[model samples]
Target chain A: EPEVTQTPSHQVTQMGQEVILRCVPISNHLYFYWYRQILGQKVEFLVSFYNNEISEKSEIFDDQFSVERPDGSNFTLKIRSTKLEDSAMYFCASSGGKPQHFGDGTRLSIL
Target chain B: TQLLEQSPQFLSIQEGENLTVYCNSSSVFSSLQWYRQEPGEGPVLLVTVVTGGEVKKLKRLTFQFGDARKDSSLHITAAQPGDTGLYLCAGIGRAGDNTDKLIFGTGTRLQVFP
Candidate 1:
C-alpha cells in the first residue's frame, strides 16, 4: 500500500541549532499533519496543512516552529533554535479524509 | 481542550488470551480512530469508528464506539505475540473556530507472550 515517508530517521543537534524534518505524503492525499510524541507520552498534534497553507495549529506549534509544502510532494517542518524540550519523535501524516496514514517518524534529540 | 484517556496503560498476557483496551473522553467526537505502533515506528491505523454505537470487526479484533460517541473499546480475541504493541486512540473534534483536529489518548501498551 502507498505510505507516507519521512527523511532522517534520527537527528541530534545542539540546543540552539536549527533543524528541518522532511516528509513525502501519499501522492493522492490533500491534507498533511505533523505530530510529536515525547518519550513514554501521548502523541501531540502540532499542525495541519491543506491547500498549501496551514489549516490549523496547536499551542505547541509556536513561533519557533513552521511547516511548509515546499513542493508538490514534499512537506517539511522546521524548528528554529531547538531547545532541550524539543526532543521527541516527529511523525508526518497524510489523509484524503477520515483515516490518516503515518510515516515511520524522525527521532529528534537536542543536547 | 479535548482530551482522550485510555485505561490499563500497560498489559501483558500469554498467547491465545483475550484482552480489551478502552478510550474515553468527556467531550463528544465526530469520529474516532485506533492505531497501533511498534518500537521505532509511527502509529498505523487499525480502524475508524464514525457513528455512535457502531461495531467493526477485523479478523480477531473487534472495535466498538460508545452510544454517546465519547468512548470506544478494542477487543482482541486469541491474541498472538504479533499483537504486542502500543495502541492509541484519537478522537476528532471541532475546535472553537470550527476546524477539526485529532486529540490522542494516553495510550495502552500491550505485550503478548508466546
Candidate 2:
C-alpha cells in the first residue's frame, strides 16, 4: 500500500531562523494537510490545501507559516522565524476522500 | 473552536482485559475517525465512522458513532500488549467534503502489561 513519506525525520534549528518540513503524500491523493503536536498536547491542525490553494487553516497557522505544493509530488511547510513554541512533531496527511492517511512526521526542535 | 475530549487520559491494564475509550464533543461532525499512535510517530488511521449511530467492528475492536454525530466510542475486547499506544479521535466539521481539517481529541494513552 502507498503511504505518505516525510523527510528529515528530525530537524533542529536555531530560534529566529527559517525551517522547512517536507512531505510526499500518496501519489493519487489530492487533499493535503499539515498538523502539529506539542509534547503532551493534542494534535492541532495547521492548514489544508486542495486544488493548488489553501482550503482551510487554523488560527495556529499564522502569517509566519506557509505551505506550498512546490511541485506535483512535494508538499512543504515553511516557518519564516522559528520560535521555541514551534518545536513539535509536524505531521503531513493526504486524502483522496473521507479518511486521511498520515506520514510518520517530522520532529522540529527549535533551539 | 471545536474540541474533542477523550476520557481517561491514561489507562493501564493487563493483557486480555477489555477497555473502552470515549470521545465527546458539543459540536457536530460529519465523520469521526479513530487513530492509534506510537510514541514519536504520527497517528495511524484505525477506523472511520461516517453515518450517525453507525457501528463497525474490526476483529476485537468495535467502534460506534453517536446518533447526533457529536460523540463516538471504541471498545476493545481482550486487548493485547500490541494494543498499547496512544489512541486519538478526530472529527471533520463538515459533511460530504474531504477538505476539512480534523479536530483531534486530547488523546488517551493506554499501557497494556503482558
Candidate 3:
C-alpha cells in the first residue's frame, strides 16, 4: 500500500536555527495536514493545506512556521527560528477522503 | 475548538483479555478515525467512521461511531501482546469543503500482556 514518507526521521537543531521537515504524501491524495506531539502530551493540529494553499491553521502555527508544496509529491514545514518549545514529533498526513494516512514522523529536537 | 477526550489513558491487561476505549466530544464531526501508534513512530490509520451510529469491525477490533457523531468507541476482543499500543481517535473537520483538519483525542495506552 502507498504510504506517506518523511525524511530525516530524526533531527537535532539548535535554538534560533532553521529546520525543515519534509514529507512525500501518498500519490493521488489531495489534502495534507501537519500535526505535532510533545512527549507525553496529546497531539496538536498545526495546519491544513489543499490546492496548494492553506485552508486553516492553529495558533501554534505562528509567523515562524510555513508550509509549502514545492513540488507535486513533496510537502514541507519550515520553522524560521527554532525554540526549545519547538521540540516534538512532527507528523504529516494525506488523504483523498475518509481515511487519512500519516507519515512515520520527524522527531525534531532543539537544543 | 473541538476537543476529543479519550478515557483510560493507560491500560495494561493480560493476553486474551477484552478491552474498550472511549472518545468523547461536545462538537459534532463529519467523520471520526481511529489510529494506533507504537513507540518512536507516527500514528497509523486503523479505521474511519463516516456515518452516525456506524459500526466497523477489523478482526478482533471493533469500532463504533455515536448516533450524534460526537463520540466513538473501540473494542478489542481477546487481545494479544501485539495489541499493546497507544490508541487515538481523531475527528475530521467539516468547516470547509476541502477541510483536512483533524482533532486528535487525548489517547489511550493499552498494554495487553502475554
List model 2 lDDT by residue over A1-111, tens digit each. 999999899999999999999999999999999999998899999999999999999899999999999989999999999999999999999999767899999999999
Candidate 1 docking band: high
Model 2 lDDT per residue over B40-114, tens place: 778999999989999999999999999999999999999999999999999986545554789899999999999
lDDT tens digits by residue: candidate 1, A1-111: 999999999999999999999999999999999999999899999999999999999999999999999879999999999999999999999999867889999999999
DockQ (CA atoms), all models: 0.90, 0.82, 0.83
Evaluate model 3: give its lDDT: 0.92
DockQ-derived CAPRI band for the predicted complex in model 3: high
DockQ of 1: 0.90
- Candidate 3 per-residue lDDT, tens place, B62-106, comes to 999999999999999999999989999989864343465788999
In model 1, residue pairs whose N, Cα or C atoms come closer than 3 Å (at least 3 residues apart or on different chains), thus clashing, are: none
Best by TM-score: 1
Of 1 and 3, the candidate ranking higher by DockQ: 1
The C-alpha RMSD of each candidate to the native structure, in angstroms, is 1.4, 1.8, 1.8
Instruction: Encode model 3's per-residue lDDT on A70-101: one tens digit a residue.
Output: 98999999999999999999999998965778
Candidate 1 structure lDDT: 0.93
**Model 3 misplaced regions, further than 4 Å:** B94-98
* Candidate 2: regions farther than 4 A off: B94-99
TM-score of each: 0.96, 0.96, 0.94
Per-residue lDDT tens digits for candidate 1, residues B1-114, read 438889889999999999999999988888899999999999998999999999999999999999999999999999999999999999887334365567899999999999
The 10-residue segment with the lowest total lDDT in model 3 chain A:
A93-102
